[model samples]
Target: MNVTTILLIFLLGAVLTYVSGNKLASKIALGFSIMAALASFYLLQLYLANQNISFNGVWLQSPKVFLSLQADGISLAMVLLTTCLMPVIVLSSFGNIYNNAKSFYSLVLFMAFAMTGTFLATDGLVYYVFWELALIPIYFIALIWGNGSIESRKKAILKFFIYTLAGSLFMLIAFAYLYTKTGSFLWNDLVKLNLTSTEQTWIFLAFFLAYAIKIPIIPFHTWQAKVYQKAPTVGTMLLSGIMLKMGLYSVIRWQLPLAPLAAKTYMPYVLALSIAGVIYGSIVALKQKDLKKLLAYSSLAHVGLIAAGCYTLTQDGLSGAIAQMIAHGFVIVGLFFAAEVIYRRYDSYKIKDLGGIRSQTPKFSSLFLLLVLASVALPGTYNFVGEFTVLFSLYQINIWYAVFGGTTIILGAYYMLKMFQNVMLGETNTKAFADVNWTETFVFVVIIAFLLLYGLYPKPITDLVTPSVKEILTIINR
Candidate 1:
């Protein structure tokens, strides 16, 4: 039940999956991911009971960095996220085919391993190590197995790789500076330093550069659409479903807590940028004819508000951001999977050709419409709960911020509903269509059920995340 065990399971599972050979690879990966997820829930229960599901060892004596993996309330939430989405991600691929099945599935498990370590690492160096470790498997996954013309995919993936890698370097610099200040890379030690306002500002920007590129708040988001369009459905799922949360989670876990003064000083500008991303992504999504690209912009808009909420530095804001992260993770995966299903049948992503699918496949259309409504933050859905709380937090700081941020509700509905109309509701497609098979049904059912259950009763999650959010707020307000 230790955090170390959780990491080991995913890593071991990944290696075993690679060795499982082609026939058994996907099953091994799926089984391993599910086992890890259920085990994570057990560990989460232990964590909630105040058990010590943590491990630490001296990995580098000279640098004084520890290979520490600890699960707290916050980390537990994130670890659970990484585990929960992983199985569904794997299951979503059960019906698809790839040239090198073993390599592709192994990469998925490896990506989960990296992401799990990222959430569980307590040492700054280890966290950074895990952070970059995540990029490797995904790079190959997209580069080797991704979709689109070979040349076009190559350009898209390289831009994505370079953009994120370049941003990560700035974060490395900041962490290096932090180690110099504290003589240690431990979270506890780093949090105790009394740095000057200027130093904090620099550190804040260093972290901001990395996170902004990932959460991809305006101007810094150019890499996303092309990458999403080019990558395979599974790669796109990994990116939007969970990888984006790495940045949003870091904002709560590292940035604001470490550089409170800088965060406060720069709040106005950050809000403007984040809110601008909200409007910009929404408007662009409104015009996108390509389904995958449209979903990417939609993700950008949703996460922009999540980033804005984190910057608010309030209990409601931070906690709401975490909830939204979970909600968006599920909703986006389902949406992208829906896009993939449509693409499989038509071999095209252009919205114009996707017409009157509802007339043919009522079951898929109904399911898709439900997910679309959830995405638009319809009442009684988890997204609505997250969105409302975040907007309320924004209103506490500035009424106008909430007003502009609120446009997502209106514009989000406009685009998602319009896309639904175009893709699922128009003229009946000329090609015969197949609805969700058992595996796809399992994926959608899990997503729909969780969103509904949580949407109706968010108190459990709110309670779980509140203490951690409040602790971070205490550091920020100090």
Candidate 2:
């Protein structure tokens, strides 16, 4: 099957889930998500066998846009991240019931469809369309189903929507400008233009603005913590786990190759900004009293490092960024699920209200400890492989870069450990904390196993991503 099949599966699953009614929506959504995962793995098999898994067709006559979906190791890795995590995201919600379950579940699958299309689309216009499509579902999901007072949640979600939308328009203008220059928006065509340094700089900043707001790098990240706290856990998972990677992926896929000189010219400043974000996010996370917000800031720190790796413009940096994207996706989901597990029993997310859970729920505490350890990038976890490689690349560029970037690990460990201590440990509380049920245990097991397995042996991921990273680097340096 071609890559289009995977997109169709999600789209179809979304439609079917919505019509299935509340009773079956969750089950149907979970089933379709698993099917999409299987389809993606099969697609990977085809890719490994040297088969073309891409789809190309004409979608419009006037603009001459082709419905192009390209698959390479890099894109497939991202696709796997989206599809695989989808089931986990859906399953993670089984413990909590929502009003309008069908609509909620449907939006979840629809967001997956858009994100998958974003990863696979090769035409600039097609990619932009998919990117914008993703925002719609999350908007409704957060606005209608999110936590907190109605007015506050509305304010947070609205600010996020406007910021992202405005930034995306800049990217659209960039793509439109590039289309005029190249007479095409295909990936191959856009990458071939030899624009003036001035042209490249403008184009680069436009795309950077789009990705930066989405990635929410540094100053652009104001909306993140509040929104992450306000959104439902599943919405947060989709945002943190898979959605954040889109901007990082776009940096490598669209930004650098299209404006290599701009990338080179700005690399130092970009790296500095990214490292600044790492330090800033980590420090901010240290003071967060809410569990989800703390995790949100921590996500900012981790992704800052990943963005730094991307701008390093080296093979190790690019590959490590992708690895960390995948690693962070799973680990963050598990971490958020841990918060949800607590909320399930205690009806709260405040660190002040939580404690003594380690004594009451040994299974949950042990699993959460593993997740926290993974978050801190413990030596034997998947995060370590990604973090180490990214930092090592920074060290090669400048020891100071590594020194500043390394704060993520040190500062990260401090905040994470402290948060864990306050939330999961301490004297037993009067309120009894229940152990994780089968669904929660299954989710934790899957995430931890993947992290440990890949942490110990990252060769498969390394091999898969290396060739693609090399190609992108060559394009950047050409």
Consecutive 10-residue window with the lowest summed lDDT within model 2: 427-436
TM-score result, candidate 1: 0.99
Off by over 4 Å in 2: none
Clashes of 2: 0
TM-score of each: 0.99, 0.99
lDDT of 2 by residue, 333-435 (tens): 9999999999999899999998998888788889999999999999999999999999999999999999999999999999999999999888677799877
C-alpha displacement of 133 in model 1, angstroms? Answer: 0.7
lDDT values for all models: 0.90, 0.94
Question: For model 2, what is the alpha-carbon lDDT of residue 289?
Answer: 94
Give the clashing residue pairs of candidate 2, or none.
Answer: none
The local lDDT score (0 to 100) that residue 230 gets in candidate 1 is 84
The regions of model 1 sitting more than 4 angstroms off are: none
